[model samples]
Target: MNGVSRGTTWRMYKKHKFLFMMLLPALVYMFIFHYMPMYGITIAFKNFNFSKGIWGSDWIGLDNFERLFGTSSSFLRVLRNTLVISGMKLVIVFSGCIVLALLINEVKAKVFKRVVQNISYLPHFISWVIIGSILVEMLSLSRGVVNQVIEMFGGTPIYFLTEKYWFLFILVSSDMWQSIGWGSIIYLAAISGVDPALYESARMDGASRIRQMISITLPCIANVVAIMFILQIGNILSAGFDQIFNLYNFRVYEVADIIDTYAYRIGLSEGDFSLSTAVSLFKNVFGLILVIITNYVAKRLGHTGLW
Candidate 1:
């Protein structure tokens, strides 16, 4: 029995050796970049001193966190901004992507479909910095194309970037536009995997295109939608920090700043690293809770879920 088990283990190892070899680079990268930096999470609990270093830093036992919550009035504001903006973006971004995928699926003309797909996907490759600059130019109060068109229509040029009420709107809209095509890729792939026979049957049953989409297409990809929703819900605290940081200004900070941005300001600008770490730690803990709850809900509902 022992000899048989040993031979079976050797056979299995030999069979999967190439697969293990293929995964080595990715495992090494994960260890070096992701897992290594996770050790810094401890700074959240410690009153970190540059001279003393991470290990030598004095243990403050939540004093940093106390300062973060008690002293910073903007803590709640930033948290609120993060959640609200992220929630809105998650809905709009995913909905837009799904809609684009469904619409593109319905296009019978192959040439036009390909052209539109390529054009939409092009924006995903552009950096947020470039997108921000382009947006600024296009929305410039004086010489922008948007203003030019507005003036042509005898309308006043609106300050889109600086307006408090409009900042979140602009952030969500631009985020959706930039990511819609790229985001649609997964849905499109899922749609492609769906059985064509389902569509044929729906057609034979006298279903219209919209009806077929509702009755046949959506149900087939429901798992994919659910999984994506779970993943998006997991990151509800992060609402495109890069995009907001680049596009926002002090004028719209009340509405535009999120936890990540506030951390940057307080930690880097104000030299309060310990407090910033606490804020970040708080965000991560809440994010962890969200992921756990979402995954649990997904599993109970009989959908594809994170394990």
Candidate 2:
């Protein structure tokens, strides 16, 4: 019996040796990059001083969180902005990418399809700083192409920046422009997996192109869509710090500031390390809770989850 068991173990190990080897790099990368950073989260609770170090820093408990939630603070506003912007981005970007992928899947001209895909993806490769500068130039009151067109029509130029009401729209639009094609890549892959026979059967049954998409294509990719939605829900607190940070200024803070940017400004810029750490911790904890809850719901609903 012992000899048989040893033989079975050795055989199994031999069979999976290559698979295990392939997984080693990814496992190590996750341990280093993802799990390692989790230890730093304790800085949120302590009054961290560089000279004293994280371990030797004094424990302030909830003092940082306390001051943030206190009255006369912009914490709530920042939180609200984060949710609104992130929620809108997730919904719009998610749906738009799927739709774009579907439309691209329908195009019969291969060269034209490839051209469209490349063009749409180009903006994503550009730096946000360059994008922001481009936006500033194009939307400028005097010299911008938009203003030139407006002047041609005998209209006054509008100030898009430095305005609270338009800030959310600007953030969402630019983000969408930059990300739409890149986001669609996953959906396109899902579309490629859809059986060609299904579309053929639909055509034989006299189904319109739109009907085929609605019934066959959409259902085939439903699992992918559901998983993406759940993952996006997990990051509800994150509002694209890099993009927003590049485009926003104090003039539009009322509508434009998000949790990440606010933390950077209050903690790093102002040197309120403890308070900033508290806010950072709050954001991370809520995000963790959201991801868990969404994943649970997805699992219950018979969808792919992040578990």
Candidate 3:
């Protein structure tokens, strides 16, 4: 049976040899960059030594994880900030994208819709370093345009980036600005795929546009939304390192420091690779568990999930 199955698989592969050839590079890339690097995960369980290399490092069991959680309050603070920032982004930015996509779908003018989409997606292509530099200048207390306007209105200039309370707001808002348009593309595509016949039928039944949207559009796209929500849950711990790393300063570290930044600081900057790896491993394991749980819940609720 095994020999017959192997022969059948080989025959199918030969039939689509060109298609398989086209897929070869992606397979190789994943093997080299993704699968190959998975071996380094062992460093999380070792007292990783630079001089001795990954393989030669001494086995340390859970010491690195213990030190990460029990050594000080810093890790806890970092974890809190990560969750807060990521949660805010998940709730605000993700929903905003969906809303924006719906609004765009309602547009009658093709040129205007295209322009709005183009403008929205442009920022996503810009590097965080560039966006950070622009933000720093615009949010500057003394010479920023925002402060200038405040002084014009006889108001005190707010140190938005430096203040802990406001730092989180900035992170969430800036992330929305950068990503909302790009994120909406998927939703927009899903909305487009919704059968036009259903909308026509609703209109014939005297349903208003808003009513059609609620009754027809939303229900059709619920599966996509549920899948995206599950994916977001899986990434709950990764609070976008590039944006935070580029925009955050020492004064805002209390509220802005996330697990990724904490890992960079302890592992790369402070040369504690073992602890860093442990932090990463913890995040991945927890994230995977969340995905599994969320997927199960979604399936039980009669929604499509990432299987």
Question: Which structure among the candidates has the greatest lDDT?
Answer: 3
lDDT of 1 by residue, 1-307 (tens): 9999999999998999999899999999999999999888788888889999888998889888887779878888988888899889887888999989999999999999999999989999999999999999998999899989999999998988999877788898899889999999999999999999988888888999999888888989999999899889878988788899889998998888899999898889988788888888898898889989998998899888878
How would the candidate models be sorted by lDDT, starting from the highest? 3, 1, 2
Task: Give the backbone clash total of model 2.
Answer: 0
With a 3 Å backbone cut-off (N, CA, C), the pairs that clash in candidate 3 are none
List residue ranges in candidate 1 displaced over 4 A: 1-13
After superposing all C-alphas onto the true structure, candidate 3 shows an RMSD in angstroms of 1.7
Task: Evaluate model 3: give its lDDT.
Answer: 0.94
TM-score of each: 0.95, 0.92, 0.96
Cα lDDT of candidate 2 equals 0.88
Considering TM-score, where higher is better, how would the candidates rank from best to worst?
Answer: 3, 1, 2
Cα lDDT tens digits, model 2, 1-307, are: 9999999999998999999899999999999999998877778788889999888999888777778898527999999999989989997887889998999999999999999999989989999989999998988888889889988999988878877777778888898999999989999999999899998999999999999999999988888988888778878898999888888888998888899998898878998777777888888789888888988987898888876
Clashes of each: 0, 0, 0
- Give the alpha carbon lDDT tens digit for every residue of 1-307 in model 3: 9999999999999999999999999999999999999999999999999899999999999988888888857999999999999999999998999999999999999999999999999999999999999988998998889889998999999988999888888889899999999999999999999999999999999999999889998899999999999999999999999999998899999889999999899888999999999999999999999999999999999999898
What lDDT does each candidate get?
0.90, 0.88, 0.94
Instruction: Give the range where candidate 3 is weakest over 10 consecutive residues by summed lDDT.
Output: 64-73
